[model samples]
Target: MASESLIKTSKYTKYTSYKKISYRSFFVGLLLFIVVSLLFIVVFNAYSGSSPRTDFHEPVNLDSTLLEVVNLKSDARLSSARVSNCTYWDCFNVYRCGRGGHDKITIYIYPLKDYRTESGTPFSQFSKEFYVILDTIRHSKYYTSNPEEACLLVPSIDTLNQHSFSKKHVSQALHSLKYWNDGENHLIFNMLPGSAPNYNSVIDLNTGKAIIAGAGFDTWSFRYGFDISIPVYSHTAEKIDSSQPDQKNYLIISTQLNIPKHYLEVLQNIASSSNDLLLLDKCKMDSDRIDYSKRCEYTTGRMFSYPDVLKEGMFCLVIRSARLTQAVLMDVLASQCIPIVIADSVVMPFNSHVDWNRISLFVPEDNVKNIVKIVHSVSKERRGELYWQLRWVYDKYFASIEKMTLTALEIINEKVFPLAARMYEDWNMPEHIYGPVNPLFLPVTAPKAPGFTAVILTYDRVDSLFTLVKKLVRTSQWHEARGATPAVHPMFTTFIMCDANRS
Candidate 1:
């Protein structure tokens, strides 16, 4: 009986030992599973949030050279104050401030030039140009001091009467000013009649000297005096050989009656006669005046809708209107057309780059007879020389429109974020940070996880889907290079979501 009891006790001891071992094993397995799950969660989150290690390929740094060239070309006359206050950034800021629902600026236009008649008829009609200027100002937020109160301040007779003007036709003259300034709630004034001009005149009110000698002087004059002036640059005419071969001729003339009627008449005659002249006009031609079918070959106008017809010509005649100054001349230069300018003021935009006398033919506005003589004198060889000179000017100052636009945007950004600008400058951030990325030039591969899974969602846009897929492929390759097992073994599976009712 004692032996049997011992056997049972031994069995019980073994069973108890077995139970304890099984419980301990189960707890150890649970703890390991929890640890592994937490570790995985951490790694997944880190991979998802972190920026991939970018391989930076060393680029050719051109900032120093570019800065040196800019400094050399820039006018030495720019004052530190002017540089700080009237920068392109400041201009952009002013534009933004003016457009941000502020008080309107009271632009007081005091004409320094005398009227054509005592009737106060303007010497030139620049209403269109003025309107465009005003419209641009209105759209920009930063220019106005108080946009709510901002308005075109015209000379009031009350202020004029205070200037000791004769009261005989005071009311009539005031009424006329009011009529002329009625559009866009703007105002204008002839400042000479009044003894004391109440408003600030853009031109020297004392000397009666018009600051801008053009049709849009009233508006532009004020803008020049108040707002920061962006130098409207253009290349000057360079001297070229007068006997060059393969010369092309372009005749540029305004067809409006506002210009002397004789100028248009002569141009019309030329258009009918000469094969070289290209007429650009906004006017609708009378069907009966010229046979369109017969003259179609010689004539190119808005009606004809020829693409870049002006650029096709080598020599362009810039007929000067009494009111128009260097505007048309600059246009001809921009078109790479050698200009025969019939106006005063040889000093225009980009005078530093171009030799005006060599490349362009400048005749005084009064000398209409010299137009034909100058045109005939320009030989084909000279035209070739001029073309090369013009091309040089264009490439140096104006070739990359995209780059210029980006530069302008940067200036605007500097104005808006002065603090950030200073910080960036201090850090020596690349000037062309937002330029094209050259994938062929990569620096180093960053460390990454072992495996990756890419899931792309797409809709109806096949092009966008295709682009996304291409980008994913590139990204996978980039990851694979960094030692990560690519999620796409054969190819990445793209899941496209499509709804029958909605795209």
Candidate 2:
């Protein structure tokens, strides 16, 4: 009986010890849970306090009437032609010439033929759209009735088909204009697909005064000099609150299946990996026929009607088509959605004046696969700052017709005025500057030895050689026969290299 009692007491002690361990473990686990929860709360609150908050209006209301602004006045000379408020369509008429503007320089726009056709509509519409801007400037004190009197002649889209697009003809037409020699006028060529470098209609006229647009590069080889690239915007621009939105999605890429296959693949990969929503409107184009009307109508209905589609997204993907830059980028900015540009090389309009880095995100074609990761690296605060930067770009470049026209005018002014001034100075200089020379008193050698030698190669032209020798012998006398010449004339001796093999 004593052995049985001892064994039962030992079993009861073991059961009590097990219960104590379970109670201790439960309390310790509860304490650990509370500590971790407090740490997370502290960290989250600190981050929220330190990070910048974007002041944004929710449920944005867009007003079409708000897009209207006052017309640009002629007397507001020195002011940057940027419009404070104006819709894209009506604003073209408001831009005026600034002080010391070129009243003699006229812009002659050749009416586009076949502009109404399916393929031609985009180019045709683009031509007409830009013409309004040019025409507005034309009426502002500088008007010319005759094409002969005009400083610049801009050919329409259909004109290319009429000319057979031979390089020689285009070159001659642009460089051989009446006032071209005077440096008072130039040719403005819009570099669309049919009008770009690859197109037969396109030719580098080598005219120093020519301005080209839509080409990938800013300056390219052409006649006399290369053409300068100007930013090309869409004729149709959207108006939204210039402020960035409180975005719900990371990116919204609306693309047709016609886009490069590689880009679509990358986008798919990004969509799979992304934590946020990735909106892709695969606007599939059915046929090969270039029908602008169908595409525009469909896009307007599907993509444009929903302005919230843009406002809800942080970045809009702008893929390069035939041209590096597109109207979509302008529209994206107008919608206040920051553009994520994917192109090989994109030259912006007035790029010299605006800093693009602050306004948009540029992703190289090769690095497109890593787009999600790259954008994810940017902090929310940085994105907010980029939004504000885009506002400046929209107000200055996209929404303001005056600003856009002024940028082109500024390029012409830079090229034309300097050459014209040099011509004027040479023409008006006093004869005394050349100094009188007595032709009869010819010397075997110049009074002062020339520091440089002027080598003249000839194939048996004795008469020309004799004339050149005389001019070198009496430098001042040569200027007397001609009008005012370059002040610094070559006074060096000519070493004529005659070909002995010439019969």
Candidate 3:
């Protein structure tokens, strides 16, 4: 009986010991859970504090009645009370009249073109007229000074130049204007020559600093300056409808031709031989040599819409003009027509957007005979490829005018305007006085010069030589501009060692 009681006691002791371990484990787990929860709470609070909060409140909208303020005198005081009382919604509130008391930067515009008038004027007149119109637009929007604010400074009709001002006059004006250096005023309008002499004078005065806007002006003069190349926007896509009559093969020749007589004669011969080419000369044709074959002639007097012309043709001839830039080439792309470029030039102005080989056939100007060969070689299958490629180009590059305009505006606002303002502020002031300045010119370190000369082997594409030379020149110039000696990198130089006679 004693032995049995001792065994029962041993079993009870083991059970009690197990119960104690279980209770201790439970308490340890509970403690860990509590610590983790506290850590998570702290992290969550820290994350919430670091995040930014957006303002979601609606702004008050301004009234159209405020537009009338444009006609008021420049010295007229805009009431701070009225502006402060005005409600704005989803708009930039002009706080000039408020407590800020900032000096407003004023931009003046003078538009010469009457937007209401349908009759087109000369390019010079158009520029001047547009300046006035731009000023009016800005003024109507109530651009004015409060204290230190950016505002539009449009002078009344009396303030505009009586006639188109000369370049000298413009330069003198630029030099004399203290307001331009004040960081609170600027001239943002276009200018036109009052007379031919004024235009010449400006050309002479501005020299390397001026840029021509359109084709009528010289582009080379602005090589060292800034130019605003306005692209012509078209809303047309070339559609190939099988239902339409295919009998009319429209040959559209839109080029500014001022080449040698021989060049014109060669083109005339080719057009005369082919009934498919339609020559649309924007200049007076050489009547004595023009081949009056079935080819239709459109003279220079009328304003020809690009879409209408492109729609009538399957193939468009893009001939190089001494005066015309890539403006027309862009138009052709917009119309989705196949451009057959006949130029002895490389480095197309619109290279960023165009794929030369895919959408267009680049023919060297020397190989005039190839024109017929290229035309005949383009089978229906090839045309299909060309069409789809052109469509892709349009979709990728010229798809959104509004987006492009907005992007341009953003650039002007964020980059150009700020830079101009700083320039004005720092005008006539030494760099040391203006705090630290960023390096405007940096040196370019070219790789080591190639031991052997690089040669490009070509059969008949002489026109491509110009492009290659231009690229080389640009690279060299870039290096020189940075005050660096460019050594041709032997490792990077490509050798076009080819046996062209084989294929």
Candidate 2 per-residue C-alpha lDDT over 1-503 given as tens digits, one digit per residue, 9 for 90 to 100: 99999999999999999999999999999999999999998899777742323122121112112322222222222212212232222322112222235422445544333222222222222334455555555554343434443455554332212123433333333343334442223345444434443532223333333344333342222221224454455544545555545555545554322456777676666666664435445344576554332222122334323344566567777887655556666667777777888875556555544556666788888998777777788778778767655655676555755556655554454444444332322222223433445556765665332243567898777667766766674553332366543444446688999878966
lDDT tens digits, residues 120-194, model 3? Answer: 221122233343344344443224332133332322221122254333333333333323332122322222212
- Model 1's alpha-carbon lDDT is 0.40
TM-scores for all predictions? 0.31, 0.47, 0.38
Task: State the lDDT of candidate 1 residue by residue for 49-147, as single tens digits.
Answer: 333321122211212222211111111121111111222232222442333233322333322122222443323223332333333333343233332
Q: Which candidate is the best by TM-score?
A: 2
Clashing pairs in 2: 206-222, 206-223, 206-224, 231-349
Q: Whole-model lDDT, candidate 3?
A: 0.41
CA RMSD of each candidate after superposition: 28.1, 33.0, 19.1
Q: Ranking by TM-score, best first?
A: 2, 3, 1
